[model samples]
Target: MHDHRRLGRELHLFDTDPLMGAGLPYWLPDGAVVRHVLEEYVREVERAAGYRHVYSPVLGKRELYEISGHWDHYSDDMFPPMRLGGGEGEEVVLRPSLCPHHALIYRSRSHSYRELPFRIAELGGMYRSELSGVLGGLTRVRSIQLNDAHIFCTPEQAVAEARAALGLIRRAYDDLGIRAARYRLSLPGGGSEKYVPDPELWRRATALLEEVLDGIAYESVEGEAAFYGPKIDIQITDPAGRESTLSTVQIDFHQPERFDLHYIGPDGGKHRPVMVHRSIIGSVERAVAHLIEAHGGAFPVWLAPVQLVVLPVGDAQEERAHDLVRRAEARGIRAELSGPGHGTLGARVRAARLVPYQAVIGEREADAGCAAVRLRDGRRPGAVPVGELLERVGARAGDRGAELWAAA
Candidate 1:
């Protein structure tokens, strides 16, 4: 397997500058393209799944986390709080997770039991005080953007919401080419102080989680759950056989109680709502890193930064090259022109292995109003009409086609 860090640098995906400190990466244009496409796809999926996306601030008062218990339990992983207005204002910390923020949104509004299963989603950027020793490319970083969401539902709808979240996770895994993953039912250990102090609550939450996991194949692992509640962690095996948690569907019984999140029930009484925290591609950066290694930096056409490069055979075709690139862009394709002095046409084409397709524009092809299309997979479908090229490429990208050549 290719090392993602090395490939990331070589392909201009992302880099870390010394001035910016460690564990924080700057996404280059190419990397940003992948991230943008992934985010768009995720938003579409969540929208269809009845999730309403929202934006939240990066920093919140210390009390915000105190209520969520992160200030007490996970402060070591969080950045130190900052005092605003000469130490008179509230102490604020960079938000570590969106759960508390989403909870606050739910609490800010009045809802009936009919709105119980309301889901809020966000691609929130977060900060963590990760040790420099553990920092690696995009996989492990201090600054991360998470595809996070919280579902506030009545007790009766909690399991259904959890199951629906699993379906989303599975769909994402399948779409992204992630395969053969196992589910781990993470629960609190017996008498562990890391977990909440309610035994009955833990039992009831665990049983609900079991009901969801029992419907599917999973292994129960004690002590692997979050401090707040039980969860199901999706463990994915990379190409190198290394397993890592790509996503999670967690049920939080403690936080709702702590934050007093509630809705009016059929009995006209306020009751605590259950919060289900889940993420399909937990961290956007980590997901990109994983996919880079999996595909050796040759991202799918839809996710590729420069899907097609126009290489002019000579100065005679330079204008035509630029023109072709313009036309491709007008058609909503990411295309660029390669100038002379870099290398021969063949050499430039070969150098662009990371790009999905290369179109050679020369006098013969320009006169014929066609392009010599070459696929990354060593197949050259000679002299295709420009219109046909656009149709094929656009369709593949629009459909999020994964192959270099759909017909191939």
Candidate 2:
């Protein structure tokens, strides 16, 4: 098994400093690029699924969580509330999840039944107070930026909304070539005061989630549900065969009631809207960490931080290499040139393994307007035309292709 923490340091992906507090990681430039690309891809997917994006404050008034029932159940996991001014000032806690803020947004304006299944999404930062013993690397951190969304629909529309969410999950996994080992249907256990007091509501939520899960193959696990409701969790097997949750689609019955959220029906009657909570990519940092380990730091071509690096053979070809870098960038390939002085071909190629493709431009190849293409896989496609190389790489990235190279 590849140690992601070691890879993280060696690859300059991220680092944590004691001065900055624990469980907080500062992303290096290379790692930041990967995160940016991943966030963009996720945005496109969410946009296509009819999710309207929004940005909400990272900290909400303590009363907000109180109304959402998070204060009672999840407050221990949240950061201590920040008290401003004197005793008169209200306390604000860093949001542990986006569900309540989104509920408030849904309640901000009146919605008719026609607007049912309203979806609001955000790539929002959250804070939690993880125990020091469990805090290790990017996988378990106090600071998390999550791909979170909440769907507010009529109770009658719950099944269709869940089905739509499952479809979105499947499409995203297919795009990234991620196959979950299995699905886990997590339901609330009885007699847990942490769960909401409404037994019938729990039954309804559990039934709805089970109906959704029954349509797909899944295992049932009691006592794993969130305080609010039941959920479907995707369990991904890492390269080491350890299963971890990567995403979830949950049915929340408690939050709507806690917040007294409602929408108007066709007959002009007020009815509570069901809340469906989902995290497509879950914590972005954890997802990236998983990808780093799964691919052994050799991300798929489209997702690699730096897709191509130009290695000039000698001083004579340095300018040519820089020009090619610009040309590659113009074609939408993430390209960079080696530092001023060139390194040995083998050393440069080895360093370029951190990237997906490397082009060693020497006097001969520069003069021929081509590059000796070296893929991450140990294959050298000798003297390919620079234009053709750019076109092919760009196409792969545009299509989100997984392979770096294939036999032709």
Candidate 3:
């Protein structure tokens, strides 16, 4: 099995320390670079899809979750409330989820029917209190940076919005090279306390999700649904063949009622809006963990921590290598210079094998103002002009291409 924990440490991607606690691993510089690129890509996609981004506090008052039923139904996985000053001070807790805060955002102002399908997105942090034994690597963590969003739309618009969300999830999976093991229609199980007790609401919400998943192959799984609603879970299998959800699309009717969310209808009366919750990539940490294992640390060109490494064969070529680094950086490539001090040309190339592109500036190539190029896949494109090299790399990274070179 290609375990991410092993690969992450080998690649200097992330680590956990005893002082910092388990399941709270911190990202190394290389890992941060990959994560930043992934996050920016998600933000750009959401912005283009009409989602208005927002920032919300990670701490919410106890009453906030109580109103959303997290305090009642899901408090075991939530951190205990912290009293601000003394015992009498107001109680606040690290939020277990972002939906409550987003519900508050939706009720901040009255809206008209035209603005019914208002979408809000955030790459924000939330905390979960997990049992010590179950916590492992990035997959299960105490803190999570979620790629979460909520779509507030009319009942009539709910299906279309949910279907669009599924489409978006598929697009993201394709770009990220993630293969879905299966789609699961998660429904409430027999435990009444595990889910909201409104049978009619559950029925309606489940039907809406079923419609959104129309013609899609999925297994209906009881007890896997969110406490407030049913959802479409996109499941991915790890190298060990263990399956877990990586993305989800859900229809929520409960939160709108809890928050009293309404918009002016065409009949000049207030009508309730449905909340469609979707996450394209569930958590930044888990997503990167999956990517690390999926690619075995040789990430796609666009997401690679160091896209290009410029190597100088000897002291004579150091100046040229430095110049090439500067030019590549100017072109938005994550370029670094590995000088002769690192080792022999072959040794340095081997050291940076995980890097997508390696441009070797030797005596002959330096004089010719070109580079002897080698790809991570062991393809030697031979000597290519410096300008052309930078352009090819920049274009490939920008396009998020899986192949290092255009032709291949």
Candidate 4:
């Protein structure tokens, strides 16, 4: 088993407690840094794709689900409603998905075919009434922050839009050095209560997915689709020979009709629009957990919670260490200073706790105006210069952990 508790505490990442209940994770300073960096990268990428970011309230009115079919289909995964104050019975519910909210946005506005594909994205929190027994670490939690996006598109734009979603997933994975990710078309279950009653829509949507998956490296997985629609689920394998679903791009054929949503067409007549649902990077918690394990806590410099840890060789050189920290911080590097312990050995030991980058600040280097950087990146190391260390750090940061410095 992975020593998540030890690593989380020692690295100052995150933790869980019996008192707080299970299925929930509490992120400490280090873990939250990972979240912030990951969110920055995700938003940057999504924005480049012309996706408009938006937010919806975490708690929605109980009746909101009745309009979205979530009450009938997804009630099993939802938290029970809360009766607020007095006179209110089952009045509030934690939203299980953003589709309902996005649908409302679509209904709130009038649009023409010219503005065909309206991509709305959010890095929002979703809650599930999961069994406390099943909760582990970040991988399985009651609360999840996901990269969710809903696209309002015409039938003709469906194919290109699907490709765009695929590109986003691929690019994100590639940036993270997840070279083995593959897509699976999650299809409707045959004769199952999980499926919506419309067989014709399922057929059309599945066909469109197959066409979209054409020439793309993907496989078809049966009975894996969400009840509402078929989806292309992205998969990634860990070092332990276990695989899990990471991201998804789903197609909805019936939600538009259910929500009574439509757009003006080239013929100037009302026509139904299709919904393209997508989540790249899946849940922020799960993704961070996998990264920690995959890289064994020795994160790439770009993703490192502490990109550079400067050690003051002695009390006399403490001022220089502080200056170094400021320089790194100014350059957007997550630099930290250490004067609590003396000597390079203490610094090395303390830096070892984080699994990367150490610098020694002694009188020799302080006089030389350059700190000796020890390249202890989970492997053999000795010393380099401060400026040289920053160059390597900057390069790794640019890579976004795509080609991280792994021990050969």
Name the candidate that leads on TM-score.
Answer: 3
Candidate 3, overall lDDT? 0.94
Candidate 2 on 133-230: residue-level lDDT in tens? 98878898999999999999988888888888888888878767778789999877866887877789878988998888765889998888888888
lDDT by residue (317-390, candidate 1, tens digit) is 88888888999999999998886778887689878978888898888998998999999888998999988998
- Candidate 4 residue 125 C-alpha distance from true site, Å: 0.9
Off by more than 4 A, model 3: none
Identify the leading candidate in terms of lDDT. 3
Cα lDDT for residue 191, model 1? 56
RMSD for all candidates, in order, please: 1.6, 1.5, 0.9, 2.8
* Native-to-model Cα distance after best TM-score fit, residue 134 in candidate 3, in Å: 0.8
Error of 3 at 364 (Å): 0.4
Model with the higher TM-score, candidate 2 or 4:
2
For all candidates in order, the CA lDDT equals 0.88, 0.86, 0.94, 0.80
Clash pairs, model 3 backbone: none
Report the Cα lDDT for residue 408, model 1.
Answer: 37
- TM-score for each predicted model, relative to the true structure: 0.96, 0.96, 0.99, 0.92
Ranking by lDDT: 3, 1, 2, 4
lDDT of 3 by residue, 1-408 (tens): 689999999999999999999889999999999899999999999999999999999999999999999999999999899998878899999999999999999999999998879999999999999999999999999999999999999999999999999989989988898888999999999878989989999999999888988899989999999999999999998999999999999999999999999999999999999999999999999999999989888899999999999999999899999999999999899999999898888889999999999999889999999999999999999999999999999999988878887673
Query: What is the RMSD, in Å, between candidate 4 and the native fold over all Cα?
Result: 2.8
Candidate number with the higher lDDT (2 or 3) = 3
Off by over 4 Å in 1: none
